[model samples]
Target chain A: MKWADIKEKLRWCAYLASEAYNMPYRSTVARARREQDDLFMLLIFSEMMGIPNPATYYTLELQPIMLERFHDWHTRMGMEHSPLDGFRCC
Target chain B: MHRLFDRRIIFVGGKGGVGKTTIAGALALMAADGGRTTLLVSTDPAHSLGDVFDMPIGNEETPLGPNLSGLEIDPEAEAERHIATVKMSMKSLVAPKMYGAIDRQIELARHSPGTMEAALLERMADLMVDARSRFDLLIFDTAPSGHTIRLLSLPELMAAWIDGMMSYRDRSRRLGEVLKVFSRDQSKEDGFGMIGGSQDEPDDSRDGRIKEILMTRRRKFHRARELLTDASTTAFLLVLNAERLPILESKKTLDLLSKFNVPVAGMIVNRLLPPDAGGDFLRERRLQEDEYREEIDQTFAGLRRIYLHLLPHDVHGVETLREIGEAMAEQLGGAFGAAKAP
Candidate 1:
C-alpha cells in the first residue's frame, strides 16, 4: 500500500477511536452546551432584566430563532437560582 | 478650502443655534452647483431642513435643487420601521399561541430609550453604504456637539460589543453541532422533551442565519468607521459664532474629534459684526467681538478659519442659499475646482 493511503486510513481510525471514547460524556457536553446557550440568551434579554443595553436593537433578529428553545432554557434557569426564577414570560 | 470640498463625506456640527444647518446646506448647494451630485442629511431630531428649504421634507429623500437632495431622519419613525421588520420575522417563527406575549415584548422594546438612537445609527450606516455609488459627495448636518459626538463614537463601541458576542456564538454553535451528532438518540431516550429536540437544528446550526445578520452589521460599522476616519475622503467641520462659549466649546469638541481619529477640517466663524455698523452700542459690541475673534485666531491658528459677516436678514429662500453658497465657494479656495474621488 502507498504511504499516503496508509496515513489516511490511520487518521480515520484515530477519529473513530476518539468518538468512541467521548460517547459516555456526550450527554454532559450537551447539557453544558445548553447552559452556554442560556447564558447567551440572557445577555440578549439583559435589557428586559432591567439592565440597560443600547445594543438590544441588534438582538431582535435573533429573537425568533431562540423562541423555540426559550421555554426549555428559561424553565431550567428558573430552578437554578437565577433572577429569572420568579419571572413570568407571559 | 479646495481640500474641504474634495472630500467624499463631510460632517458639520457645533453648539446649538450656531448655524450648522445653514453652513451644511450652503456647502451642499455649492457642491451641487459645481455640477457634483450631493446629498444633505439632517441627523438632528429637531429637523430644520423643511424650514431652511421652505419645503416639506420628511424621512424620504427630497430634491433641493439640481444635483442636490435632502433627507431628514425621524428617529421615532425609523424605530417603528425597525419594529415592523422584527415583527414580520417573529410572526413567522413564533407560534400563534405565543404571539401576544411576543408582541408585547417587542412593544416594550420599542419604548426603550436607546431604541431610537439604535435605529438612527442603523439608518445612517445604510445611507453611507447605499449612497456610495449614487452621489459625488455627502454632507451631514448633525445635532449639537454632545449628541453628535455620542452618535459618532458608537460604531467603535458597537463593533467591539458585537465581536464579543460573535466569539461566544461561535463556541455555542460548534457545541451544538457536536450535540447533534453524539447525543441525538440519547436525548430522546432520556425523555427530556425539548420541542426543538425533535425538530431540525437550524437556529444556531444547520442554517446559521444569525451569523449572516451579525456579519452584515459588523461589516457595515467597520466600513462606516473607515469612512469617518479617512482624512483624504472625509472631513468634520465645526460651525460656530465668534463668542466665548462657542470658542471654548469648539475647542473641547475639536479635541474629542481628534481623539476619535476623525479629521477636523476647520471652523466657519459665522454671524460676525460688520465693520461699518455706525453706533456707539454697536461699535462696543464690535470691540468685544474683535477680542473673541483674535482669541479664535490664536487658538485655532492651524485650522482653516473663514469669517462670515452677519447677513442683513435671516437667511432663507433658494436665492439666499445660493448667495451664501457663492461666498463659501469664494472663500473655500476662492474657486471650487471640479475635484472628487470614489
Candidate 2:
C-alpha cells in the first residue's frame, strides 16, 4: 500500500528469485569444486600414499596451507585416517 | 681440451671408485693453470675433493690453487639448507600455529627419497646461474653413473611437474574467481583482497602464491634444462678405469646420456698401468688392462680419449694433482684446439 513497503517487498521477491535460480547450479559447481580440490590434494600428497613423487621437496612448503583441506579431502575419500595423520605430515 | 675449456659447465660421471674426482680435479686444475678461473663443484655425497686437494674444502669455494676453487656440496647439509629455505618462505604463507606440523612434515619429506638429490640439483642450478659470470668454467664431479644420470634428468622432470601444477593452479584460481562473482559475496571478496594485500597488481589475482612458486621453480628448471641440453655450453665426460665393468658401465652411461640429449664431451681412462712395469703381479694386471683398453678404444672410438697412468702411490695433495693435470692438458690439447676452430 505504501511506496516504502512496496520497495521492501519487491526487494525480498528478487532475493528469493535469485536464490531459487542459483541453488541447482551452485550445488553442481560445489560438487565439481570438491572433485577438483580432491584431485589437487592427490597430486600434491601422492607421495604420502606411497607414490614416488619427484617434486616432494618442492611440495613440502605447501603442506602447511593445505592441512585442513587435506584432512577433509582424505576423510571424504573414505579413508579412516589421513595419509600423514598420525605423524601429521599433511 | 679446447672444447672442454671453452664450455662453461662440465659434468664428470662414471662408476663408483673409478677416480672420477681425481680426473675431474685434474681437469679443473688444468683449466685453472691455463689462467681460466675454474670452479670445481663436487656433488658426490662421499666427497673426496678435500682429500684430492688435501685440504679442508667444505661447502664454500676454497682456493685449491691459482685460478682454481673447490666446493663440496654435502648432500645432508644441502638438504637441511633447502628445507630451511622452504620453511622460511612458508612462514609468510601459513599461520604461526601451523609451523610445527608443517615443519614436521618437511622433516619427513627431507628424509624421503629423492630429497637429497633434488636439493643437490637445486644447489647445482643455483651455482650454474649465479656462478656463470663469476667463473670461466664450472666442473661438476657428480655421483656415480646412475645417480648422475637421474640428477641430470631432473630438470626435465621438474619442468613437467611445475607445468602441471601451474595449469592446476590456473584452473583452480579461475574457478574460484568465477564462484566469487557468481555468489556475489562482497565480504568474501574483501577477505581475499585483504589476504593478498601484499600484492596490488590485477595480474597478482590470477596467480596464487603456489602458482608463483611453481613459476619460479619452472623458470629455474627451464634455464638449467637449457644449459644442460646445450652442446656448446655443457659437456658430460665419462671417467672409467681400464677394467671390464667400468668399460661396460661407461658404455651404458653414454647411451643413457645420448638418449637424454646430453653432450658427451669425451672419455677419460684412468689408472692405466705403465707399459714397462717390471713386477710379475703388475705385468699380469697390465695384460688384463690391455684387453679392456682395446675394448674401450673400439667402443668409444669416436669420442676423444684421455689416459692417466696408475700412480705408484695414492694421488693426494696439489703436487700429484698437478702432475695429473699436466698429463690431461697434453691429452686434451688437440681436442680443445679443435673446439676453438669454429
Candidate 3:
C-alpha cells in the first residue's frame, strides 16, 4: 500500500485506540504518530490491528527519526484531508 | 568568616554530565574538614557516588573524612524495602487469607506515581531524623534538575496526603463508635478498635504507632524544607559546563528554583578548558570557554561563579577529591583561599 494510505489507516487506528482507552482523542493520535518510526509500517500495523496507541513495548522502542517521519506524514495528511476522517474508526 | 560553608544542606544539581557529583564530593570534604559532621547522599537512580568516591557506597552510612559520611541510595533496594513495609502493614490489618492479595496490591502500589522517589526521600528524612545529632549537615548530590524537583517536593505532597488520611481516619472512628453504641453488643467495642485501633489490640497499636511516626515525620520534612529555602542554612549550587545544553538547562533550573522559593547560592562552571599553553585545539576551546564564561556571568548576575580547570584524569578516590576540594576552595575564596599551581 502507498505510504499516504498507510498513514491514513494509522491515523484511524490511533483514533480508535484513543477512544478505546478513554484518552484524549487528538492527544492520543499525536502520541501514536509521534511514536512511529516508518510511516508505511505504522500505517500497515494500524490497519492490521485496527487500534492506535501502539503497544507499550512499541512505544518504548520508538526512535526520534521514526517519530519525525510520522509527524511529517501526519502534517501532510492534515492539510489534504478532513480532520474528521479518522473519527469514523472510533 | 562569612559563614559560607555552615550550610545545613548543600544541594548540587544541574544537567547531567556536568560534574555535579565531583563538586558535591569536594563540598562534602570541605564541610567535613571544617568540623561539621556531614552526610553526602545521592538521590540519583543512576548511582555515581560509588564511582566518584572510588569506594562502595551502599544504603548504610560510610565515613569518608574526619566527620563526613556518604550514602548512595539504591532505588531497587529502597523500593523493595518500601514494598516489604507496605506488605507487613497490610498483613497486620487484613485477614490472613487476604494477605497474599494485599501483598500483590502493595507491590503494584510500589510502582505507582512518585512512589520510588518518594520512598527515597522518606528514607533520607528518616536518616536525618535518626542522625540529627550525629550529622550537622546533609549534602544531597541530587539527580538532574527535573528528578531532583520531584524528589524534593515529595515530602510536601506526602505530608499533605497523610494529613488528609489522618482526618479521614478520625471520621471513620467516630462513625464506627456511633454504629457500635447503637448495636449494644460487646462486639461494638471491637468495632471501636477496628477504626481507631484501641489500646486493647496490640496489632492495632503497632499500625497506629506507624501512623503516629509518619505524622511525627512532618517536622523532619518541615525542617528539610526550611534548610533548603533558608540561605543561611542551605546553599543550592548549580554545576554546569560551558556547553550550550547544560548552560540552557542551568538557566531553566535557576528559574524553577526561584519559583519554588529555594535560594540558589552560586554556580560552579566545571571542566573549563584552561587558556592556551600551545595547541590550536586548546586555543579554540579557550575561545569557546571565554564566550560561555561571559554568557554565564551576564545571565546569572549577582551570583558567585566558580570556575575549575579541566583535569587530565577522571575525578575519583580521596586524593583526586582533595585536589578538587583545594580547587573549589580557591574558586569560592573559602578556606584554601588561593589556587595552587598544578
Q: How displaced is residue B228 in candidate 1, in Å?
A: 1.2
| Model 3 ranges off by over 4 Å | A1-90, B166-214, B334-342
List, residue by residue over B103-219, the lDDT tens digit for candidate 3: 544454444545566567767777645666778888889898888876666556655644654554455344434433433333332342222223224424433653465466556
Candidates 1 onward: DockQ, in order: 0.24, 0.36, 0.01
lDDT of each: 0.80, 0.79, 0.63
For candidate 3, give the docking quality class from DockQ: incorrect
| Candidate 2 stretches greater than 4 Å from native | A78-83, A86-90, B88-103, B185-207, B335-342
Q: Please, what are the lDDT tens digits per residue for candidate 2 over residues B1-342? A: 776789999999999998999888888988888899999999999899999888899989898888999999977888898789877865666678777766776677877998888889999999999998999999999999999999988999889988887776667566555554446642332342222122224424424666767778899999999999899999999999989899889888998898889999888888888777788998898888878888887898888788888888998887888899887777665634231110
**How well is each residue in A1-90 modelled by candidate 2, as lDDT tens digits?**
999999988976776686577656655655665576677788778877778888898877665456545656778899867667434424
Error of 1 at B307 (Å): 0.9
Lowest-lDDT window of 10 residues in candidate 1 chain B?
B333-342
- lDDT value for model 3: 0.63
